[model samples]
Target chain A: MRYEEYNLEDLFLLAKKGDGTAFEHIVRQTEKQIYNLSLSIVKSNEDAEDLTQETYLRLWRSLPDYKGESAKSYIFRIARNLSIDLIRKRNRTPGSDTVILTADGEFERDIVDHDPDIRPDEAFIRRLTIETVRECISALPPPMRELIVMRDIDGLAYHEIASILEIPEGSVKSRLFRARERLRALIIEKNIL
Target chain B: MSKHSCKKYDFMIDDYIDGLLSDDDVRKLEAHLSTCEDCRQSLRFSIALRNMTRSAALEFPVGLHERIIESVNEDKKAKNVGSKRKIFRLGAISAACMLLCLCCTAVFLMLPGNRKSESKLPPDCPMSEAATDPSAMLPSFNGSVNAPEKGEDEGYTYPVIEEPALSSPEYDENSPEDAAPTPDETCAEPEEVAPNDKNDYEYSSTDAPANPAPDVMTNNSNISDRLENAADAEKSETHPVASPEGVPSARPGGEEITLALLIVSGLLAVASFIAFLISLSSIRTHSSNKENKK
Candidate 1:
C-alpha cells in the first residue's frame, strides 16, 4: 500500500524537527500555486521565480516562530508581500522589454515570423491559449488581476481569497464577478474563443 | 452585461459554481437554470472558462523546489545567520545615522563658513598702520602675521591717505559754525577753539585720545594725518558694531540649514530604528509564547 499523505500538522512537526525531506515535500506541493501567484503579480518568470524562492526562504526561516497560522495563509501572505515588492520595483524602472501575449497565446513580437507550412498542433495551441489567458489576466489592474486569477484559476475559495487579500468576502465575490465579466469580454474582443 | 441578466438565477450562478450557496439557494438556481437558457449557457461558459484557466495556471519552474529547499537548508546550517543578518541591517542603519552625524559635525567644525564676522577684518581693511611699511611688516606667504623683529621700524613708511569728505549733511547741519579751517589756517598757528566750535572740539577730542589736548592744534600731529587716522579708526570701530547684526544674518544662512537638516534626519533615523528593534522584540516574544499550561 502507498504511504499515507502527510497533513500540514505532520509536516509542521517534521519540519520543526529539521526534516529537510518533509519540508521539501511541502515546498514541492505549494511551489506551483506560489509561483503562479507571483507570476501574475510580477508578469515576469524570472522575477516570479525570485519571489517564489524568497517566499519559501522566509517561510523556512520563520517556521520556528510560526505558532499556528494555516499553511495556505502563511504561504500566500509571504508570497504576496514578495510579489508586491517586485511590482513596485518594476513600476519604478519601467521601459524594459516585458513579455506580451496575444489571443492565440503566441508572442506579439514573434508573430511577425510567418510559417506558412507549419501549423501549431492542438496541445501547442492549448498551451498558447493558457499563456495568452495569463497574459490577458496580467494586463488587468493588480486588484482585479489577483482576484480573478486566484478565484478562477487558482481555485481558491472566495472566503479564502478574501482572507488572503485581507478584504471582505462580499468584496471578493462581487469584485471577482465584475472582473470575470470584464476578462471574458477582453478575451472575446481578441477573438480568443 | 450581467446587470441586464436574470436577477434571481444569474446572480446565484457564480456562487453556485463555487459551491458557496446554501441548498435552498442551489435548488432555486437549478430550477431557474433549467428554464433560463441565458443563465444556463452563461454558467456552462463560466465552468469551461474556469477549467481552461485552471489548466493554464502557471506551473512550478524547473528546480524551484530544489532551490527553495536548498536555501532553507543553507539557512538552517547558518542557524544564527538570519538573526545575524537582521542585526546587521539594524546596525547598518544605526551606523549610517552615526556617519551622518559625524559628517554634519565635520561640516560645522571644518568648513570655513558664516563665522563670527567681528573676529574677521573687512576685505578692504589693511592689517595695521604698518601694512604700508614693508620694512615694518615682513610679508608672510601663509597669511599669518609675524611680529616685527627689533629695529624693523627704522625704515617705516607713513603713507597719508586723504580722508573721504564727509558726505552726510548731518555733520554740516550739526556743526554749522565749525566750517573746516583752511590748510594754511590750520597749520599757520595753533588756534584756540572759538566758542561756537567748542562742541565740535569736544566731540573730536572724546574720540581721539592721541589728540585729546583741549585745543585741536595743541596735539602735535600733522592735521591731515590726524584726520585720516581718525576717519580710519571710525570705520574700523563700526565693523564690530555691525557684526551683532551679521550674527542674526548668519543664523539664517546655508551652513546652519544643512546642519539642522542633518541633525533632524539623523535623530529621526535613530529613533525609528530604536522603535523597530522594540517592536521586533515584542513580536518575537508574542509569537514564541507557547500555549499556557492548565
Candidate 2:
C-alpha cells in the first residue's frame, strides 16, 4: 500500500504508537516542507538539514503526547520553532525583520542577470517567478519570512498558521498580508517581474 | 470613473486574491479592478506571487527521510541502552562518589597540621562565617558566581562593592602585568565584570554588611590607615575569639572544599533523579504509543 494513501491523522496515530513504518511515512510526507521552511529561515543547506532532523526527532519523541490535530500544522509548528531558535542562536533581531537589499550585499549576491525583453516559455517563467519570490522572501524579517512560507508556500490555512504559531488568527491574516505586500514591493523594486 | 477611489476597496485586495471575499465583495472588487489600473496590476501581482509560492516544490535534499528515521531510531536505541545500563552506571558513579568523598574527608581530617594555608585574598577583612561560604566575604553584595561559560571571563555577578586592586598591597594597579580596572569599568552596573577578582568573586549573596572602602581616599597613608582600622575594628567587634591552638575562623580550605563537595554531591544526586524521571517519562511515552497502536 502506498504511504500517501494513509490519512495524516492515522499515520500520526500509528507513528506515536511506535509504528516505525508509519513514522517513515510521516517523515516522507512532511520532510520536504520542513526542510524548505528551515532553509528559508536559516539560509543554509547543512543547517536546514540539521533543523529537519531536529524537527522530526522532536516530532517522533513528542507525537505520543500530541492529542489529535492536523499533523501538517503540528509538524510545521515544530519546524518553525526550531528554525526560530536557530535564528536566535545567531543573535539576530527578533520577530519580523526588514532586510534592505543592496546590489553588492547578501540579498542580491546569487541573482543572475536576466534580460527583460528576452521572453521565456511558461515553464521558464514559472521557474523564474518561484526563484524571484525566494529571493524576495529571503529578504524579509523571520516573522514575515516564515509567514509567507506557511501561507503561500505550504498553503496552510489561516487557522492552521494561527494554531501552529499560537498567534491570533487576525494576527496571522495581518502579518501574511503585510508579508505579501512587502514581497510585492521588493519584486517591483528589484524588477524581478 | 467609478464613484469610489481605488483606495476605498484597497483593503479588499487581499481578500479578493485569497478567495475570502463574499460574492458581493467580489462584485465590488471586480468593479473596482475594472477602473483602477493600479488595483488591477496589484491583483495580477498577487495572483502571480501566490501561484509561484503554491507551485514552489518543497525540494528537500535526497534521502532526508532515511536520515530522520535513522536518527530517531538511534536516539531510541541509545535511550534503551542507557536505561538498561543505568543500574551499572549508577552503582559505578555511587562507588566513585563514595570513594572520592571518603578520600577527601580523610585527607582533610588528616591535615589538621596544615592549618596555616592562608587565603591569598589580601588580609583586608579578618574572616567571618563568610569563610565557609566565600561570597559572604563581604556582606553588602552577594551573588552565586557560576563559572563563566566558554570564552567568558565572569559569570552573572550582582554589582557589589569591589575592592580596587590598587587598595590591595600586593598587586600594583599601574604595573603592566596586573593593571587595575578603571573606576568606571568597576562601577558600571551591568557591563563591568571585575576580571581580576573573578576567581575569588564567589559571592552567592550580598546580605552581609561591611563598610565599603571610601572611594575618595586616594592618598596611600590615609588608605592604609583606614584599612588597618577597618581590620582592627572587624576583628575586635565581629570575629569570634579564636581559641589559642587553631587558625580559628573555621577550617578555611577544608571547609570550602567540603562545602563544594557537598554542593557537587547534591547536584549529582539531583541530576540522577532527573535522569530517572526522564526514563520514567520515556516509559510512559512508550506505553502511550503502544496503547495508540492497538
lDDT of 2 by residue, B1-294 (tens): 442465466568878877898999899889877776666655665677778777764566888778888899998899677775784576566666666666666666566544444442234423333333333222221222333344342434333333444324344523544433233333221112343343443333462244232232222233344444544444444444445565555555766777578567656766665665676676678768768758
RMSD of 1: 19.2
Q: What 10-residue stretch in candidate 2 chain B is worst by lDDT?
A: B135-144
Could you tell me which residue pairs clash in candidate 1?
none
Residues B154-225 of candidate 1 have per-residue lDDT tens digits of 432222222222222223444444333233322221222222223443455355445432332232233434
| Model 2 chain A: lowest-lDDT 10 consecutive positions | A108-117
Alpha-carbon shift of residue B256 in model 2 (angstroms): 38
lDDT of 2 by residue, A1-193 (tens): 5567889888999777678788888887777878878877787889899999999989987987978898888899899889878877886553344454354323422333233223233443344467776777777666678788877877788998889978788878866766776666666556534
Residue clash pairs of candidate 2: A17-B289, A97-A141, B135-B203, B139-B208, B141-B206, B142-B205, B142-B206, B143-B203, B143-B204, B144-B204
Candidate 1 — which residues are off by over 4 angstroms?
A1-4, A92-132, B1-8, B80-294
